[model samples]
Target: MPKDSRQGSTLWSTVLADLRTRLDAGEFTERFPSDRELVAHYGVSRHTVREAVRRLDMIERRPRVGGLVRTPPTVLRRLLDTLTALGVQTSRTTTTGEHHSVEIAGRLDRAPRTLLTVHTAVLRADGGPLICLQICSAASDSVPSELADMLLDGSDRESGQVSVVYEGTVPAAPDPEVCEALGIPTGSVTFCIEARLDLADGAPILQRAYVRPDRYPCILQFSAP
Candidate 1:
């Protein structure tokens, strides 16, 4: 029997777990299983299946209708979930860059225990012409010495190592300095994550990522506990 068969909350959690299991098992084959197939396999309504799928997307990205799904990383980075916690109560992320933009300017109240104050940031992501960040210290800071070297040498970095930020209000466009930092052309677009990592000794690690926004949307569903 499954771990939790009880209805409502328990059932929802079970479904979400099972959905992730199937995806990891290659049930989707770089594509989504048909709605009918999913319904039959999960023995649930279309709505329930949709909710389960949505959660998997938030935890791990999936393929678009015709795009290929990227392979999940072998080692799940612990940092991703911790960073996402700041966004749990988010409302109305009204722009192309919603999922990836966080306002580093105002993360003072509930800053993560691992981070010190994020003093300031200019560049926030990789894949741009010049990925630049001048992070200050926290006693336990673990940002590799090599990373600083990598950025200064003009190497293009992925968005994960950094985060993106936006004011609570939407803007006409993402920060151009961020685009330039990420090595993306001024006009080219991508999905990004703006965040503040409480690093070293309560030091704030900030990012301003520019990414293809349509590719990512943090979704959720509810069920029994």
Candidate 2:
């Protein structure tokens, strides 16, 4: 005779263990399997499946780097989550669109003539400038106006999947606008993170970010499976 089934929690734990093992083997690359699929495969209840997924999320916690908050580098994060984690208030400083530069266009896999929206905002700690963020996204006729509005509001909703992220320091030259917004001297260095999010077609959807290093130093940390 076959062995009896385990309890709900016990079965969930067993399934979670199996999933983790598979994850370590790089099974779920693009996206995780659906909860219903997991439930069917593991012979567990829907509640059990959800609890297992929740545990995976809590296995890792975000870290604070200076004034910036970043989640484990292994997972992708939305801009709002990162800002909210700082536990500080913020306000939008500027939101404008301009013709894409050759370099930026190349990075975004878009045409130089394409109009790209530049969204800039300042994060405040105790009513002072902590960091300034500038995000650039595609503003083509193909993209819906409502979705474009979200990007202008500094959101990456329905943007795409993050394919690559690069971090470096840019030696700033005399820029009146940056100097004014960040309250820093000309030629001051700025920390920048450029992420390339790609659609299923493998075309870039968005790229580029800028932050004040002095006020919002950031670090990337993660663990091996």
Which of the numbered candidates is closest to the native, going by highest lDDT?
2
TM match of model 1 to true structure: 0.30
Per-residue CA lDDT of candidate 2, range 1-225, in tens?
Answer: 111166766766777788678766767554566666666677677687677766675233222211111223412234335666866565544445555666666677677776776555555554666455555666653433233234434344434423344433343442466666777777777655455555444545443344565655566454453
Q: What's the CA error at residue 131 for candidate 2, in Å?
A: 3.0
For TM-score, the strongest prediction is: 2
Give per-model TM-scores.
0.30, 0.49
What is the lDDT, from 0 to 100, of the residue 71 in candidate 1? Answer: 34
C-alpha positional error of residue 19 in candidate 2 after TM-score superposition, expressed in Å: 9.4
RMSD of 1: 14.4
Regions of model 1 farther than 4 Å from truth: 1-6, 58-225
Error of 2 at 20 (Å): 9.9
